[model samples]
Target chain A: MKILVVEDEKQIADFVKKGLTEQGFLVELCDHGDEAMERILDQPYDAIVLDIMLPGRDGLSILKQFRKKGHTTPVILLTARSELDERIEGLNTGADDYLTKPFYVEELTARLHAVLRRSSDEQMSLLQAGDVSVNVLTREVKRRGESVRLTAREFSLLEYLMRSPGRVYTRTQILEHVWGYDFDPNTNLVDVHIQRLRKKVSPDKENPVIETIRGVGYRVCKDGAE
Target chain B: MTPRSFRTRVLLVSVAVSGLVLLGFAWWSWQLLEAFSSLSGLDTELVAGHAWLASHLDAVRWFRREFLFLFALGLVCVLGGSWLLAWYAVRPVDLLIDAAEGITAQDLERRIPQRGAGDEFGRLIDVFNDMLERLEVSFNHATRFSADAAHELKTPLTILQGQLDQALQEAPDGSPLQQNLGRLLEEVQRLKVIIRRLLLLSLADAGRIRVALTPMRLDELLGQVIEDVEILAPELRVIQELEEDAWVDADEALLQQAIQNLVNNAIKYNIDGGKIRFQLFRHEENLRFAIANTSEGIPEEDRRQVFRRFYRADPAHSRKVDGVGLGLSLAREIVRAHQGKLWLADAPEGWVMFVMELPEGAGDGAVESGE
Candidate 1:
């Protein structure tokens, strides 16, 4: 997949670009909105991570212009502000997703994947964790190329966990992402689901694919070899 | 009139009138003595004696005794009257001096009572009172404004420093610098918010708060907001319980701005990917909009001050959220201008809920008065 990162800070942009490239994604870095706009218009990008702050034209204006011109490619906004109103404005201005700065690179990569997968009509989407692959198109799970049976909700939760590896996912984030806004008020639903999923996916292993963060949330390591 | 003041004025006027009468009497007595000496019948010797009073003691004895006695009596009366006059004049002046001397910065509540003299002294007292009134007003506004501003500025500046320090201490040089840059940007954003709020409040105070009240549906506005924020953090569950077709008469831009602020506050202070429960319903004579997010409950003491300009409950949240603490304040002001009320309520599950109630036709006209 090809991604364009438009950020003003050269170092951050370079760091993000190098990380994504190492993860097998073609990455292009641009500092200004004008340059990013030119590249976006000329070439098709699978995803575009747009920073809200730029020198010439701000990210919001760029997003607006792109939306006006009917460019519907998935756009992730990297904003220094975690303000609710600014985030709302960014999203209303046609950004597909928004991330606050001081974020983990791995987290950004996961969100980028989620946004792209949801926005695009492509099937055969696969997210890999340690010795595990969760397929979106087939709704199937494979551990070391062995097929595993999982419930629908289990598969959905596993997919979310697999997308972002070595990053913490709070209980609230898990609740919102998995059960959405309307869910039962059980405190241990997440723990129960994780245990059930582990039973099916990581049999005969002391440490499972999902690792519990004490007093916090859950994490899975990147690079299935681990 | 107090009996003392009236008695003092009466005594002063009476004493001056008596002193003038005494002087007239003294002059009359001397004239009478001269006329008696000038009488024609067998008065040649007497007239000569009176004219040469120093030469003939027998002829001038009667004249000297009677006229001298009368002159002494008049002199005594004049002295007594003048003493009374001076006493009355100086008494009020002394009172004024004592009152003025007692006034100080610590006790602004003191007021000079109009002592019923109804003279220039009374007018002076009134002027002094008016001066104190103006001083109190300006002093209040200036102090409150500075306190709020200082509090607002300090948070962002402190945040910027904290983030930079954390970066230096914890993360690698490159990663932490990036984080520091992010925090610096946040501080700048907070400064902008504070300035905007301050300007708006001043404009409101100056009676220049202009409003373009329009008919707008609350549901649609919130729906758009939900749609927008959902894209920003798809992981966050924002449930909207908007009453459809609920209309309000308000300044369209300002109302939207207020809602945006409240939602932003909710999102910023909320736990990561926490549930944001939004509700819109009409209460008696007002439309209510409420947003609740799971938060560490605000202290009771801080609850009242939360709407005060530049007030923050937690330093960590204040630093991370990048707000200058004016969002809620501005929102409260806008609501008040619209003849509405804004308040914070304790929510279930240790959440903080911000509730805004807007009257149907508030701010349709200019806000009646600021205070």
Candidate 2:
């Protein structure tokens, strides 16, 4: 997969590029907005990570111009302005995903994959990590070829973690993605839900499919375990 | 008293004093004229002969008619002149009221037109303009400070968070170093939350929160909030008395945040096994929302101050609750920004009830979405 990261801040651009490259994806970095626009029009990339604040043209206008010319590449907006109205504006301007600044690279990668999968025509509805397989369309989960009963929220949470296995998500990220942006930030809801999900999915907690990153968040095991 | 009331009193007193002075002068002139005629002995001269007496009677009748006409004219002139003077004196005050009424939060820089120097109204305008200047300066400072602080703090925090994430990734699984890094990351996350909330409040204080108003089903929003609340506090029993199709014109995201904050507070402050009753209904021209929870109600003295910034009922901060004390303040601000009123209502059964009343149909003709 080819990805273009357009950010004015050199540190962030370099960090994002290094992280994505280490993940085995071909990543290119562009620090200027105009250069990014020219490069985007000149090449075909699978996904684009655009920042809102740039030297010349802003991220919103660039996205607007890209969409006007009928580019369908998945774009994720990176912004420091966490205002709700600004996020809506970004989405309305043909952004496939929105990530506020001070975000985890893993979260960004997860959102990237999610947006790409949504845009691709050959997207599969079934997500499999280990013996647990989730069918997104039907909201069904199966473990070891047997059905598992999960609530609506549990299904959503499992689906989010399964999208990118072996990547850690923070509690805040999980809450924002699964529970929504309005969920209280101070609650232990994530831990409670995770415990419930584990009990339902793995009756014997000795060999759990989901692994906790200590103070971070939960992630699905990369190795498929039975 | 307000400058407006003071000016009104001055006008009234001036009119009364001028009217009394005019009446006194008229009475004195009438007495003087009668005394002068009596001292000139015209009455005795006329009574000396019959012909003289007859002429004197006719002359007396003519003088009486003229004097009555002149007195009536003088009274009309005095009243009219005083009324005009009072109106002239109060004209500046009326202008000031008009100007003040037109000033809104968004237009705080607007000033009243000043009169000439060395006059009362002129001095008033000067003082008002001086106050406005100070306000504008302080408001700008606060707005700028928050924006700059947010920008500065977020950049370093982002860098720190990124560096920590990178280090955690490289560390072997189950390592002691990884555990310490995780703890550090949690602290950073907590700081991030504080900074985010602070920025939110500052923006709200600056009146810079942009709301995208849309017509949405209030019941549906409430249902979603309840679902979220259940996940957060599963022990609390939530009863919903939502009216069907209670549509409201509001900024969906902002209103959702406000309602979520209230529910979160209820769950956070409630005792174990307490119940939360969520009710929604329309009252006249307002859409009313009442969220009542079975908790120890706030003290009567502290009820008014609960919406103040960083005002916790538990001043000692002994409650193990995890909040920076910005929720209620932010909620009230959001409500006020929406032209709504949010207050703590007296609950009959010792429950803490928060009632929000928002004017209906405010979002008419508003753009449904942002571009």
Candidate 3:
């Protein structure tokens, strides 16, 4: 995937470029807001990471301009402003997703894939990691050719993890995506649900597919190893 | 004393003085007329005769009519003059009232225009303008502080979190460094939450938080919130008695935040396996929402303080809960911004209920949805 990251802060921009490049994505960086807009108008990229505070032009106006020209490239907003109205404004202005600063890079990649997947014409009706597969249209889960029953939340959580196998998701990210907005960050709700999902999908403890990234969040094993 | 009463007293005194003057003039005129008739040299016996008596009575009637006309004219003049004086005296106060009505949280720079120096109205205007100046300064200071604090704390925190994430990614799996980094990241996340909430509170205090109101279905919003609670705490039993098509003109996101905060609190502070009852219905001109949960009820004294920032009821019990005690305060602030009222309602048995009342007719113009 080709991605453009427009951030004024060089260090943060370098970090993001390096991370996305390491994730097997073709990454390009632009710092100035006007140049970024020119690049976006000039080229077609899979996704763009646009920062809100920029010289020449701010992120919101650029976004407005991009949408005004009818560019449909998926854009994720990077904002340092934690105000609720700003977030709402970003989303309302045709942003595919938004991440407040001090966010995890893994979260950025996951959101990128989610947005790209959402915008792509050929939607992956089924998400699979090894023997575990979930049918998106039918809301069905199967493990090793055997049917598995999951709750509504469990299904959504599994679907999210399976969408990007081996990618780490912070508890906050998972809670925001699976649960609705305004969840208590201190609750053990995510852990408990992940535990339930693990039990239901992988009854054999010795060969579990879901790997718990200690001190981080949960992830689906890339190889589905025992 | 009130200015109104003072004006009333002045009017009464004016009327009494005018009446006394009129009575004195009537008495003097009566004496003069008696002497004038004696000077006319009419015989006492002739004056007592029927024709003379009729003429004398006619003259007295004419005098009485002239006296009554003069007295009425004097009374009207006195009353009208007093009324005009009262109105003029209260003109400054009326101006002050108009100025006060225009002052709101959004516009604290408004001041009562000072007339001049040394007089009562002038002094009042000076004091009022001084107070407004101080208020505007403090309000600006607070607003700037919140914005600055958010910027100062969030930027560095973001950098710290990003660096920590990068370090964790490079560290070997299950290594001591990774574990330590994880702990640090958790602390960062917690700090981020605290910072975000603090910013929200400060914005609310400064009245800088803007609410974009739209018509929304209250029932649907409640259902979504309840569903979230169930997902988060599936063990707890939740019952919803939502009124059909309950609508409100609200900032949907903010209102949802408040409702979600209340539901989350009910779940967190609830007894193990406690039941939560959610109800919503229109009460007269208000749309009311009530959420009750089984818990060790808060004492009446603490209930008043619960809505205060950072005031936790039963701190020991709340130690296990995951908030900084701003949820209720923020919730109340949001409701207040919407011109609504939030209160702790009386509950039955061991249940503690919180009720929110939003004024009706706000959603009257909103498009109605069948579902």
* Winning model by DockQ: 2
DockQ each: 0.03, 0.32, 0.30
Better of 1 and 3 by lDDT: 3
Over 4 Å off, model 1: A61-72, A81-93, A124-159, A166-207, A213-217, A221-226, B1-303, B306-371
State the fnat of candidate 2 relative to the true structure: 0.34
Q: After superposition, how far is residue A66 of candidate 3 from its true place, in Å?
A: 5.4
Model 3 per-residue lDDT tens digits across residues B252-348:
7778878877887898779998999999998998999999999988887887898998878768845445457878888898998788999988888
Deviation (Å) of A140 in candidate 1: 10
Sorting all predicted structures by TM-score, with the top scorer first, yields 2, 3, 1
lDDT of 2 at B322: 37
Per-model TM-score on C-alpha atoms = 0.39, 0.79, 0.78
Measured with DockQ on alpha carbons, how good is candidate 2? Answer: 0.32
The 0-to-1 C-alpha lDDT of every candidate, in the order given, reads 0.68, 0.79, 0.80
Q: Please, what are the lDDT tens digits per residue for candidate 3 over residues A160-211? A: 8886676666676687667644444466778888999999899888757688
Model 3 DockQ class? acceptable
Q: Write the per-residue lDDT of candidate 1 for residues B55-149, one digit (tens) a residue.
A: 55455457556777766777677667666766765666667667777876445557777788678878888888898888767755764574356
